[model samples]
Target: MVAAYQKLCPETLDGACRELADRDPALDRIYRERGCPPLWQRRPGFRTLVQIILEQQVSLASGRATMKRVENAIGRVTAQSLAGAGESGLRAAGVTRQKALYCTLLARAAMDGELNLGRIARVRDHEALDMLTAFKGVGRWTAEVYLLMALRRPDVWPAGDLALAKALQAVKKLPVKPGEDVMRTIARPWRPFRAVAARMLWQEYLCRNRAASAASG
Candidate 1:
């Protein structure tokens, strides 16, 4: 079982923001301007995992739209419903063929009792990641995202996330976007609260882009 300390809540998120801001001026600016970033916690289960799969390699808005389509196609996103919908149904619902295969694979695993969400919740962080990634189409990024958003694991960082990379580039004022290795290295100092730091950077990224779009419009 995950320790209480390891699980992030709204209070801990704010505390983490304060701690991080005290150490980094860029993070401080985010807290001062944006306030504490939203907890953005997702429920831990099969449905949330599939949503993360949909998000892979796509814009968040696009991913969300596709998820809504899936919900419209199937009554709900449970393992039974998804399996019944099959790859063709998912593809017709706006999922790419590749992602359709992935969603089907996950549904089969869950239905067969091979992938237990309860077990995943009880396991250690690395073990949880390993179990999630054991299935095809669940890569490190997918698994990390599940831990960070769904499980609310305090330290998990998705170095492969494009938004976080862009935010890092902007916050650090780098000439180019950071590669995964560079991103990991830079994030190391944030330690047990790296996930909160990620939220802060994401806030900066989204707000800045929204402002830019507003200005352009």
Candidate 2:
């Protein structure tokens, strides 16, 4: 299933929007307000999960740089190389101390066959979340992001994400950022396509926050 979804990339955002808009009027408005950004599909594998771990609490640029360094040092971002890397070496690659440990743990798990990322696409969202979070460095938000973006699961949402909360507040005209419980309730209607909704919201956020968009640009 993972392989099949990976094949679906190069999937046009236009098609996704049309389908989503047909499913929900509110989503149509969102698509009209902000054109969907191209889906940033990632290659599936241990290295990809390692990169996700690197991405926690950091800017995308920083994460990319750190990944590049790690890749260069090891010649490949595989479990074996990462597990063999010393803490000082990982730190030199710009990984935080905690993240380095997480990466190492993830690498070891992958090498030992304890983690089976390829199997996730066959499971339900809740099961997938549980399976992913069993890994040392993985949590709900990380797993959800992986499911939504990487696995291309339609309904997954990372309610804990501050960016998504703020985006929802601005787009929905909320008086304040919605808490996780509130977000879950509000997001229910977008079910079965909430991942698409998430993409739309993030795009709306960039459009509404020009300064942030420019900075990221």
Candidate 3:
């Protein structure tokens, strides 16, 4: 059963990309131009969850910087360390007050044994998502990202991700970014490999934007 939905490693990652490219021309173009996307997997643990929470509604770089500050402030980014830091320490470490509260609540949940990150890994994707979203700060986007990146679930699609919207627009050559429902519709053909499709779009988004930035600068 564990093998039924195994995490995607490098070999499987490339396979998924090939399969997805066969289905979508835009994704095919991404493979032709950018090569295979990185697995971008994260460790399934409290620290990574905290990092995802920091990423909420913020740029990925900003989220990473804040997470680094959190690590600097409290050494290891454990539930215990974050709990000790509390909201004030987190805010001092460059976390916004709202996010600090969210992190504090998450830390409390983990420390109290309410959230079992290990147990979550053994469960199905929907169950894992439900377990994670049970926490205060872990919304659908956060939970789905954790599933995609940390759990390495092959099929998970994160709805309402701004980067994804932008990437979809750029790749599909739409006049504007897609809305959530439209994104859902657009993503349907990539079923069971939507996560790989997402990786491709993200690559397109980042590389295209970076090139545009360089040209302008």
lDDT minimum window of 10 residues, candidate 3: 1-10
Identify the runs in model 2 with alpha carbons over 4 angstroms from their true place. 1-26, 211-217
Q: What is the lDDT of candidate 2?
A: 0.77
If both were scored by TM-score, which would come out higher, candidate 1 or candidate 2? Answer: 1
Better of 2 and 3 by lDDT: 3
- Local accuracy of candidate 2 as per-residue lDDT tens digits, 141-193: 88888887787776788998777899888767799999999989988876556
lDDT on C-alpha atoms for all candidate structures: 0.91, 0.77, 0.89
Which regions of candidate 3 are displaced past 4 Å? Answer: 1-4
TM-score of 1: 0.95
TM-score of each: 0.95, 0.85, 0.95
Q: Which numbered prediction scores highest in lDDT against the true structure?
A: 1
Q: Is candidate 1 or candidate 2 better by lDDT?
A: 1
Writing each residue's lDDT as its tens digit, candidate 1 over 54-115 gives: 99999989999999999998978999999999999999999999999999999999999999
lDDT of 3 at 120: 95
In Å, residue 181's CA in model 3 sits off its true spot by 1.2
Between which residue pairs do clashes occur in model 2?
none
